[model samples]
Target: MTNNMKNVFDSSNTYGMAKTFVLISLYALLIAIGMHKGVKIFLYIAGISGALLLTYEWFKMDRPSIPTFFIAPLLFLIYVLISPGTFLIDARLAGRFACALFAGVALQFFFSNATYKVLLSQCAALLTTLFLGVTYACIWAPEMFDDRLILSYRNPHQLAVAGAFSIFTLFTYLSIFSKKKQLLVYCLFVIIGTAIFMTVSRSTSLGLLCAFAAYILFYRSKHLIKIVVAAGLLGLIAFSILPATQQQRLIDPFTAPLNDRTIKQRVGIWYTALQGFDEAPILGHGLRAYSDYDSDYKEAHRAEMVDKNILIIDSRWAHPHSLYLGSLFGWGIVGTLLLIGAFIPAFRHSSGRIKTFLFLMTFFSLGYGLTELRIKSDDGAFILFFPLGLAYGSILFEHLSQKNKTTSEYPIQTKPCITKILTLLN
Candidate 1:
């Protein structure tokens, strides 16, 4: 065996199984404890543990795939110097993001290893099936549910994100490698789409709509104008049949200012974030500095509004409602630029399907970020990084050719090459 191949299949490594089990275990634990308000301590512990394990594995590498993984902790290190005496925020909250980067980078290392890759594919499949089941229950038994069918999520928004992400991954899989199963994939789209509707998450709903439109426009454009006309007619017909309240829910965001308190507050929050960004233009006021300063911002807004005879009631909200602005506030201009720098090289090197997956992930996250702060939130960090890691891992596998070899422990000859089942994920 060549030295590189030997490095790829090292005795120190457990052929990706051990890494897969550890990453997935942490992911599951995050999902379970993430929604609890005061369980951040657990997340911090998980982050530190995961980081230490990955760091150890990293040291065993002879050749590490694209060093893009260094950006998160690099930014974290900068935050350490510029922190606003808020190590708790740095260690516990923003640390999830660092952990996520570690996971993604760690995942990249296992791309040539079949066992880890299968873990990711199996995970996507499991989530899709669960979403289908939840969708079925919501569609057939409306009376048994409340306004939204959240399944086990703390809120409908979480359910929506999971459904939308699963549906996107399923389609990506079909387009890239599962062409023989196109019909089955379409069926899944229908099932998952119903639950997305049930969630009533405006961000995910709108994002899904745009993604579907883009897919049809780009891929199935044989009769582009005709398809557009048919879609328009169908949309109008559907709109006419909906009840007045449902119609308003869909239409008010575009037409009525009074109906979009969410949007208005988002605008206000974005403005304040910009103001904060100006103060800490280099390194930021530190992690969650916005949270600490938000009350003062609201007071300033109320004071200004008093002169205009405007009463501000219940004006509290979370981080700036944007990926760009949230990064701007937490990491500042330099830090934000470093974060972007990390993604660019990996993106340029990625193959087609990998790029497609990453693009959709970015699109959905950015779309939602316009109205809510994700990517740093509990559920957001987990959902975002796992697939991101998979994407980076795909690039790594592409760089190194796959080969099957039997392990001494198993004695059974299973395919060592990941491509036998799923080529893209591993």
Candidate 2:
């Protein structure tokens, strides 16, 4: 085990410098994502810079290759470019998605050889800091949107999604850390969980529930029962502590079925999105198609509600509420399949721990997507793709390590340009 750990870090100085830059950029990206405002520009700059650097380093290496995980985003970008009804904005959105995937791939590729203990420790620390910042904001500079927690720039649902993702990550990676680190994660988990509840986002709550279920089913751990019980008690305590209105909001869907305006509105938006899908079943109506059919949506929404004797309401939603439905409406069945195909390679090649992590991420994303469009934009796209990229990179690294062993060949070394510069500085 010691030898294997040594082998994992045995890279040339040039590769080490590149890895340093990539890791810094990744940390920057995470900070940007967790910020409320004025940091997204940093995310864009860091993401693009990291992607470009990784691409250059990748091509400079011998036998440079693109991972199968990256192919789907590339293809999706192409489809968005040439497909009918796509505008410049649509193409731009597609470009962002592609960039995000590549960014994730780069992050993981560079960190591929690092032990989970090292990788997850950095992640846990950064995430805990972010949650602490959010917690402070919630207390000292609270921003409320419709009685739900919102940061300066993000909406309630977005905050909820971020909190949910952070919690899911900490939970999945819990077992990899030491006892002290585990305790910190538990505290961070409570902080993030309370924040999520304050967001009053039922969809995100549901997603968290689904992620927990997936973790229990697939994540092999000796302390699973203890972890589950602790989480349950924490969750119950958090819920109990929320303001009455927030608690009521969380349970509103279950307690007051007909009084849920959001549900009714979503049903209407979904109907309209599906109607658009029927028109272009193969390729859908292109990006942002849901908004284009506003008149149709309003009509369908009113008619649908009339049948149930529900009060008719006006809606001007920019995108379909559901990610799956949005994809079906905008990209159609073929494009959606392409999107799904991107993950197959990662799942095929990754280890059991990675597979479990990916499964939990996917399950949570899908569950959250049932009522929100997450991956279509920059913030949410990064949240979904970055970890996935890490998994893919690890898989590729493992494969290469094994192949080198079988052939009795030394691992390929990178050029020393960055190494030379660092040496000059030192």
Candidate 3:
């Protein structure tokens, strides 16, 4: 047997079981993204099963190297339990967070394995194709809300976020394919990009643009300048080709009275969130505490709008629209710092495609968080955390590879099984 093939299949039977469950969790995650129904059931299957199996595997290790970031979730959970605003705690919300965290950690283990990393890349490509096909079907017969595209997902923003995530995944996996397959992936990008544009989500568009720019900057490809110029030209072409209404919306959404009012209301909520933050700067309000003040913020914002001669249409505030603001308000400064700090090690250690992928995810998430909350939502957690776990997994795997002096890098044609899968995909 070839050395690489042995490396791929030499893992203990228990670790193999862990890998199998992790793959199932990821597949379940993709299904959850498209259907959105039975999300909790799927999440539990993914999180609990993978977490338990991975923990077993960890215990079996002679000297397991636990990544520092894993501690962040446990610490955050403790803070949630002990911090002020216990009354505001939502058990379901906490449970969802736990599920996502465990699933993410399981993914970290999956990526750390050389064989599973390649398998994941292949699985992602195949599942993404199926996902985009479904999205295209939905787009073809879209349920439009005020000329906005809502496909499968109840909210247009949800569809947009899904598209953005698919695009990111496709881009990250693009390198594994031959040039012909790469062209096909680019076509998929066009379809996803068109769907995103149809959503008319200003924040998502901006976030995607920022993500692309970050990718180009950090990727440092030989054709960097050419890629930038091409992107600019493509942007202009896309804008010109968009429907007049969408163009107007993209250029200046405030030109429409409804859009103007919506923006104003969002601003008011953000201001109110800041006020909440100021009230409890240290510990902050508990998780979902923003909901407690939702009615008050809406009434106060309604009065402010009335004073400005603006119409009050929808005055309901569920949660702060911004992730950063929500984090601050929910956990206060200490928790927020811990949350951000957790990513520092992963960012520092990750390299190559993993680093690029991490940067794109971080940039897009931060940019999108400016106008919307994602981490708090189930779909958002899957989108944000799973890939994050994969990136960290790569980092940890690299460390192990170096320590053990095994071939950790993804081997293209070393394993016949993987090669056959790639061939089918190509």
Model 1 spans with C-alpha error above 4 angstroms: 1-17, 23-58, 61-73, 76-88, 111-146, 176-180, 209-244, 307-311, 397-426
lDDT of 1 by residue, 1-426 (tens): 355654555553444445445555444443443232322444444455556655544444433443455454355445544554434455555566665555554444443353233333533544554556557766886553545556656777776776776676666666444556778767766666665665567888766666666666766778778877976775576556545655677677879955566666665677778878887788676546776566686676777656644334455555776778888887777767766765666566666655676667766776776666766576577555545655665654554333322112223233454223223333
lDDT of each: 0.58, 0.65, 0.66
| Residues 1-426, model 3: lDDT tens digits | 345544554442333444554565556565566555566677778878867755544443434676666576566656665656555474556566667766765565543333234324433543464466457766774434337776456777877877787777677767887999999888878877876777788889878978887767756677788987987787787777667777887766655645665576676667778878998888888757787675665576767757755444455666888888888887889878866766777677777666666788788988888888877678777666655565556665566555553222333233455434333322
**Residue 156 of candidate 2: its Cα lDDT?**
77
Which candidate leads the pack in lDDT?
Answer: 3
Candidate 3 structure lDDT = 0.66
Clashes per candidate (backbone, < 3 Å)? 1, 0, 0
Quantify how close model 1 is to the true structure by its C-alpha RMSD in Å.
6.2
Regions of model 3 farther than 4 Å from truth: 1-19, 34-37, 62-70, 81-83, 87-91, 111-146, 221-225, 253-259, 297-314, 398-426
TM-score, structure 1 vs. true: 0.72
Query: Using lDDT as the measure, what is the rank order of every candidate, best first?
Result: 3, 2, 1
